[model samples]
Target: MILYGGNVVKKAALWYILIICLRVSAKNGVTQDQVSSRTNTLFDDVDDTQKQLDNEVRERLAQPKTVWVIHIPTRFPVLQLEDLSVTEPTFINTALVRSRREYQLGNPELEDPIISNNTTPCENVEEESSSEEGNVCDSDRTESEKPSEPEKCEEQEEKPGDDWTFDTQHKWHENFPDCAGQSQSPVDLPIAGLIKTRGARKLLFVNYNEIPNNLTLIYNGRNVILTGNWPRDRTPAVYGGAAHSRRYLFHSLVVYWPSEHTIATLHYPMETQALHVSAEYGSFEEAVANSPKDPLAFLGVVNIYKFDSETQAGLRTIINSAQKCKKWSVSMKPMPLSVFSPPFKEYVCYQGSLPIPPCTESVLWMIRRRSLTVNRESSLAFHSMLLGDDPPQKVFIRVAQALNDRHIYFFR
Candidate 1:
């Protein structure tokens, strides 16, 4: 409407060709619902930038609820694989699991929790014993959630001379009825019917001259021990002998062979004895279970008598340490506790029991009122050293028992 400068320049090139034919009819007159509304506004601006990057990755893996404690030491039939997991969704296959196998506890619909200790723990939760192992727990578990059983591991402590031996030990009163009571033992001493006591005394031999660098020997499967290690104030004791008025201590020597207290009617082929104990009790089964009716134990004997002459050097080092015990134990070597305490200028005392087994009658024995010759090649090498492991018949005087109403003192 204002083209006046003329025909000016031909009306400005005819109004620039009518303004490019009206923008080519407004770009070919676009339509089809404005190109489907600009292609859904460019996919709604990429779904609002993927919802702001999934809210900044779920606010950095959010996790706050404070309070989660744990301590672990556990033992015994248990399986806790903590938080066991597997929220499987195999592309929506939907498989949620939490297992631990045996002694289980992963209740994903439970059925495996019988925590037993000899039975009684029914807790079938839902059904997950790898898919209900024959599920069976609907007894309405009530006995107050039962779970108190776990005490069965403390047994070994018997030894009443472990079933007796000293050769059939006269059927050890059939499992030791104190070997048939009536106060049993190697009895039969009667050195000319002793009994001349002044309540006898004069035996105390403390530390019998120390002497003990080794000593063990042992056999206890019956006879032959030796013992003695010392210290605890140089051990070795023996209290005023005859009838040891408690002090005891000293402890081992035993032996036996062909003799076991038999002086008068003579049988000494070898003996030895010596034990002791009760130094205010601390063993010997706490001094015979706290001195039952007194005499906490003593014994002393010596016996011997083979004589062809010359094997005595402490009986050839205790018959060469009992030829290294056929099987039990050995270690010997040391010697002098007064070469096995043999100086008793006379002693015979008695009160019997315990030549072996529960033969316990709380002994006090004594005996060394003379009789120790040894030799005949050390009693035929101590009776041919347990013939390689003897024990099958031929038992020589099986420790001479029977002498009932015991009495024999003599301590002159």
Candidate 2:
């Protein structure tokens, strides 16, 4: 029996009905072979009838001065009617019937027909529509497919010399060979070694008594930096103890949290670095280029978060200023340099390199032994600010490097 269907759902339902009939016949004592034979015969009869119709259509289409019109339904509204012509009537008829069947079955492969010519057969119209639809469907499927495992891994892999982050420590040596050197910064300070050291000179701070009134809070990719608006001649300088008679000019200050390195098995909740360059160099870039060996000094101060209901006045100002500036943005405000400075002066001296990349060695590191107190409210505020806009990694701290026979001196 032949079934006529207008939609794909109907055709699918018809197929299910045929399968049910076959199962019923088998249950009614019909042999399996006989039931299979009957099913094949029914399909063969339908195929023959379809072939005959196609042949007849083809023969008629071959006649001269003949115009065939066909109707096609699409998901969208039928905008206009079109006439399509084909030389082989049988092929055109078969294609049209196949397309109509597939569309009714809810096949995503069917394309909308373009019916411009009223004289063309419906089969020809369907063939044109299917061609366009196939291209679009295939292209979309290809693009939407999930990427392979290897492709995802490649995207996540860190490359050498890319922006430095805490997780990218393995790639640091590849980018800057100096990172693997012996005198790298942030070395673990054993409490026994620091206390046992003798002949350590006291550190002297020059012009650090007054805080610079004009300063800006800049959110670099890694940390929040405080840049001062002090002239080259008027910039604060520090010497004494391990600072070998050479005055280090204070440049910028960076604030960090969750101490990058351990000291006497203790980890501070926050840390800050006051970066200074050699006074001999005119600019920071010049100092880095000319004195590649050891031209910078870092005064490190660690801080512990205390449970205080009120936030520190200086820290509250920084948090407020950061809220006005977007991530990775810099905004100038009337901030004081003393706000970010350490409260205590007693420190431990050591020789190390820049903790960050290009990892230049020969830096005089003066880490304060006493921990500064930051209010719990302000500490939470610091964590709220993001490092940069769309940063690859959210972590701001770098991993501590090896000590490699370096001595830690305590200067009171």
Candidate 3:
């Protein structure tokens, strides 16, 4: 019994020592409360430091890199959707060149810099800087702040127009040598056929007419239905619209084919005022061409009165099928073609003077033809200009020329 009691007491002592050892091993000479408090303080400090670091990063990013920008003088600066890229940031750099010498961005030897912060006339600078000041400026300006009715007053005030000529220090043309004396017109042009020409050139229209021909003993395996007539003297057949020097004559003919394969011609630029006639029959083979600089080179099918993909696809499929067919008839109209429905294709009658310098008589016009089926809804949402809802409208076709009693032709 005594031995059993001794063993019990020894076990209890060993257990108490183990408990003390465990407690000592768990902490570095600190109480549980003290350790917890210190840990909380360290965590709070880390959190506050992290927040401050995050704020600093944000502030640095928010700051704008200020640079002085100038506009270089140009006769016509055409702005197109192609000029802007969603993936690219536009940073335009302007340089000032003089007859004496060309100066770049930095040259520190001079006392007064070329562009000073005070002289840099960026209109939005003040607003942006004030915004950067943030809540501090808001608090300071509280007493001085006045409720602004900008929306009400905006309509009444006349905003300054964006003048292209503004801040132009030295006009290049004014100082440069005049080349007007070197300009002269050519009497007769060299004829070209069956060869391609290169370099920048202008095409002035001479004449355009459609002449019908039957599917004769086939030429080059394809049925040649219409032959375009370019007069011997590639000038306008009839000049004026009146009897004395006004009334003009034009050849207008309709082509008939079996109902299967319809024919339609697409005039590109849709706005070419003048016809550039090459001595050659085909445009592609003509060496001296008068078409658009970069004419849409790809082949696309055109219906008489509308732009139909199904009809195009059907025709393409038929052509691919290699079937020997005898009969097909296609229809065409005299005036503007009419083969489209509402919304998808709209027809608006416009009466405007001819785009040419002479300003010929107005004609009845119908424009909408193609019902372009977009692949996705996101494709249509490109209207946002990085500003607001006022998306710009694109002009697919040029303004129609004034019809001066001229009969236009089509394939039926």
TM-score-better candidate, 1 vs 3: 1
For all candidates in order, the CA lDDT equals 0.52, 0.53, 0.23
* TM-score ranking from best candidate downward: 2, 1, 3
lDDT by residue for model 3 over 218-313, one digit each (tens)? 111112121123344432222211111221222221111111111111211111011222222344223213222312111111222111112221
Root-mean-square deviation of every model: 33.2, 38.2, 33.5
How well is each residue in 140-195 modelled by candidate 2, as lDDT tens digits?
Answer: 33533311111110112233554676667778888789888888877765534233
TM-score (all chains, Cα) for each model: 0.23, 0.54, 0.17
| CA deviation > 4 Å runs, candidate 1 | 1-188, 199-215, 218-223, 231-233, 239-252, 257-259, 262-272, 275-299, 302-328, 331-412
Candidate 2's displacement at residue 364, Å, is 1.0
Give each model's clash number: 4, 11, 17
Pairs in clash, predicted candidate 1:
109-127, 110-126, 110-127, 203-241
Q: State how far residue 344 of model 3 sits from its true place (Å).
A: 20
Error of model 1, residue 98, in angstroms: 74
